[model samples]
Target: MQYHYEFILATMAVLGILFLFTFFKTVLPIRRNRMFRWLLVAESVTLIFNVLSTWYNSSFGQVPLIVINTFDVLFFIGFVSRDFLFYCYIESLVQERAPAIRLPRFLVWTVVEVSLLLILTSPWSGIVYSINDSGYHIGRFYRLVLYTNAYSYLLFSIGIVLAAISRNVLARIERFSLIGACLILVVGNIMRMLYPTYLLMDSFYMISILVMYLSFQNPDLYIERKTGLLNQSAALSILQEFGKRETFSVFALVLDDFSENRRLYGVRQMDAGLRIIADYLRTRYPDCFIAYLEEGRFMLIARQVLPVTTMCRDFDRRLQEPWHDIHVSLYLTASYVAFCGPLQVERPDIFLNYVATALRRAEEENQLVVIDEQERQRADHDAKIRAAVDWAITNNTVEVYYQPLYGTKEQRIIGAEALSRIVDPELGMISPGEFIQVAERSGSITQLGEQVFEKVCAFLAHQDAVALGIEKINVNLSPIQCRDERMPERLLAIAGNHHIDLSRFKLEITESALADRNVLQNNMKRLQEQHAVFSLDDFGTGYSNLMRVLRFPFSDVKLDMSFVQAYFSRHNRLLPAIIDGFQSFGVQVTAEGVETREMARELTRLGCSILQGYYFSKPLPEKEFLAYVARTQHDPEHTIRF
Candidate 1:
């Protein structure tokens, strides 16, 4: 029996030394983690108290034995406090960005401290344990008091896991770790009470601690160190775990105008703002779990659909005041796109992707945009158009369709505007109006514009334009082309390579393009110097300052079809005056969409210099447009609608 006691002591000794070695080896920079620090203190105090109690249990002298038993009870009382501390550690590990479970901290601690006070002062009263002549002996209510307190801590630990799961906060692995740790202690404590003589409870706690160390310690890899929030990978894990069910809403929050802030304050100052943002979310959004996505981006998961009206009000209020916690005073705004789930989304990646798309649209328009059926269809359409445009650009199959710009005075095809048409073998013909927006958004306009210009050059090289009495060929320039610094050189090279005269080319720009007067003037001057003409296209469709646009060196301005058709009956309102003003400035005016010969006769009477519409010819392929030009120029008596 003495040898049995010695063997038990040796086992405790071995375990004690092992814990100390592991502590020193694995706990570097451990002070930074409050959870691990609480855990360390709890385990250390428990290990020391348990070892001393076992050794001094059989000491001979009654005085020493009484003191030892008292000291052991003091340590035993301390274990009750450690139980709550252990629960605190676990709570911190699983808390994520918000409160996981609301245990009344004040009430729980009060009950625990009161229980501890009873156990510590038990020697005098012998309510928990008493020292006697026979040996250290147990009090009558020992197991009841001990277990009741221990079970309270167990209840807390279990509460955290269940709350996290029901809220859809934890991934599968997180659920496994938390549940496994609680089970180990629960089963181990039952065994300890059943076989009191055998020392199994401490070993069970150590095993649970080991499980937790492996589990919670990995958070460093997935958490943002600056703000202590989960990063994208962990956020994605939560989404994957709960995306299919109808448990929660995921929100994508974009920091609007973040680039402007970064430019003004620099990166260090922006980081300070971001940290404050993390803290702010923790307070204001008490029920949401947050993930630190890329810079100026964040993901928030909550138990139900967000009150969009409330959030919008808050958003407005936040922007109305300047916050001072950052490096400088800052006013900010955010775009919130909610992922309405259970019915709309079927998978995590799809939910995140849709949220991203909605957020982008909101940011672009500087407003709140929802991802509904219309938005989804628009996204799918844009994607298809983008893919078809990419394939068209790669294959060099982009075709140029020419609409004849007939000089009404000549009553013949004098020139034509080169419009790009995409005729794909797979998708068939894609309208210019549909794919042009896609090209602009994707920044593929530069490539697509160059290809169209090349196709126009190829067409001119194939046609006998000078022999066919052509004055010029107009090519539409996108806003993206207007901004490109290399536009003049690239266009000149393509025309020169095709041996077409630059004087026979006209570049049509929108009225809005002239808003940037300086750059547009520079590019236009360079092209004008090379003997090319500039025409303002779709003139009255914008806020056309006719005087302001004529001030630029453009030789012609095309009248928008809407104004021409609107004034066919009501001709004296503004159209006649606008056309006279352009012709007086030596700027030729062309009226397009002359669907009726009545519209054409009225525009010709209004002193419009040129006419273009389906009444003369719809936009035609390269070979057919040249044929019409050749046939009309030769047959001077070609029957006019007049």
Candidate 2:
């Protein structure tokens, strides 16, 4: 008995030293987790009592059983309190909130503490111990005390398990850490039950230390590096767990132009901007978790309904506030989708996808749009458009239609622009704006553009090319095709094989196609060397101001339809300035979308030499365009007013 007492004292002393070391070591890293800190303090107190109990039992010949039982009850109380604190710590981690140490609200904590106090003070306290016949004190109610201890530990274990499952606080790695801790506790409890020894239970303390160590090992365990919020990887894990037990609504606010801003401001400045937004959100919604999904986008999940709406409005307002010394306007758009009731979303990825789709639709409409049933219908329409585009690629469904370009002075057919026309025999004709982007995204535009160019070249080789006195045929180049290095060589080879003059073919490239200046310059130089005239199509639509016109090697420039639409409006000053700027560069100007005879006369007064618009004809098929050109050749002064 004396030897057992000495061993227990020595073991308690070792545990006390280890606990102190762990407590000091964890304080700095986990200082924010007040609940965890309190748990460590409670654990230290429990170890101190165990040490005192061991000393009293060993020093005195007839030590009071009540004193030993009192220490046992206090130790058990400490264990339960620490276990509850562990659950609170997990809840804090998952919520990405700093844990606050608050007095227990439920009757459970009061009942346990009060029961412990009563058990320690009662006369029956000695029931846990008895004086043996050989003048030695021994634990008598070992089975009963063990059962009570097991029940108390079981309550703590169940609380932690419930917290873990309900809160979804643990990541995959954290979950494994938790499972390891539970395993150690289970093994320690089993050993205590079988051997009736306290030493075996102390072995599990090492596992708790390991669990703490593991928790701190993850660099982004608490905060994200990118946005200074909880990362998506962590937030998604928490959301997944939160979905299981409770009914909460989720709303996402995405920032627009995050990447462009990042590029403009540099990485450090962008991160600082993100941190500012994150901190603002954290201060406003203490319960909500924010994450940076991409450089220019953030995902915020909140429980409160009205607060989320208010939060989104606030976020947009803050984003719109101009950054110091930055000339760019802070244009931000946010789209939100809420999930409630029985339709619970377990996967964050799917929820995020829906949010992204809603955001894209909102941006397309260029307004603050809410995702409703109509938006879902729009999404369905988009999906069908995508499918149609895919079908067009596989089945070679896209066709090329010719529209004649007549000389204003000659009134005869000069050339034609080969326009892309997708004729779906089953679904009929789809809009160019609808499937053209899809074709570009799917990399089918390269193939489609080449096909159209080949067809235009083939038509020029036939007898129809000679009948109309076609001097040149204009073929519009897709931006994707313009990027291809082989495009100039391919066009030249096709012209040479057909015995067609390269000088007779005009290649129309949009202003958007000149985004990559180096690629554009190289391709333009190569094609220009082959005597193929280059025209800047839809010239003024993009960032093509007068300065761009001076830089680009264009033989002809087509003014955009928007400029022509407002030609006679109050903004008429810009049209003359644009034409003067192009004429100064010795570039022949073509006015697109000239509908009325008044608009055409105004354009001619503005010194626009070439005209192409509905006043002459809408885009016509090959035969109709040829006939229209023949009729126009006989009558140069014919005025068809729209």
Best by TM-score: 2
Candidate 2 regions with alpha-carbon error over 4 angstroms: 1-297, 301-306, 320-357, 364-366, 425-427, 440-444, 463-466, 480-504, 634-642
Q: How high is each candidate's TM-score?
A: 0.53, 0.55
User: lDDT winner among the candidates?
Assistant: 1
Encode model 2's per-residue lDDT on 1-642: one tens digit a residue. 432333455545655665555555422223324555665666666556655665565555566766655565666556555555555554444343212222245633654455455445433544444433343244455445445544554455455555565556456766666656656666766776676534545546545644755564233464567666776665555455454545555555655655445545566766665666667767876766666666455565655444555656676676577533343333344555444422143454444455556766555554454545665566556556667777766776667776666566554557777787776765578888877876775577777777677767776777466565677777888888888888888888777777777787788898877766788889989988878788889976766677766677888888888878876676656888888988987988988887888887788778887777777778776677767777766555652332
lDDT of 1 by residue, 1-642 (tens): 121232344445544654554455433222224555566566566656665675576553534766686667756765776677778777765554234265777866875776787787777777888776676777887887778788888888898778878878777887898899889889977986887766666677767777776665545566877676777756655665454456667666788877666656776777777788788777888777787876587777876888866776786677688656725666678877765656354334445556666777888887777667877776666667788998888898788889988787887778898888887676689988878877886788888888988888877788667787787889888877887778889988888898876787888998757656677888888998899888999987877677788778988889888877777656537888898888888999999889878877888888888899988989999889877877767766664454
Q: CA shift at 249, candidate 2, in angstroms?
A: 5.0
Checking candidate 2 for backbone clashes, the offending pairs are 258-296
Candidate 2 residue 119 Cα shift, in angstroms, is: 45
Give the Cα error of residue 509 in candidate 1, in Å.
0.8
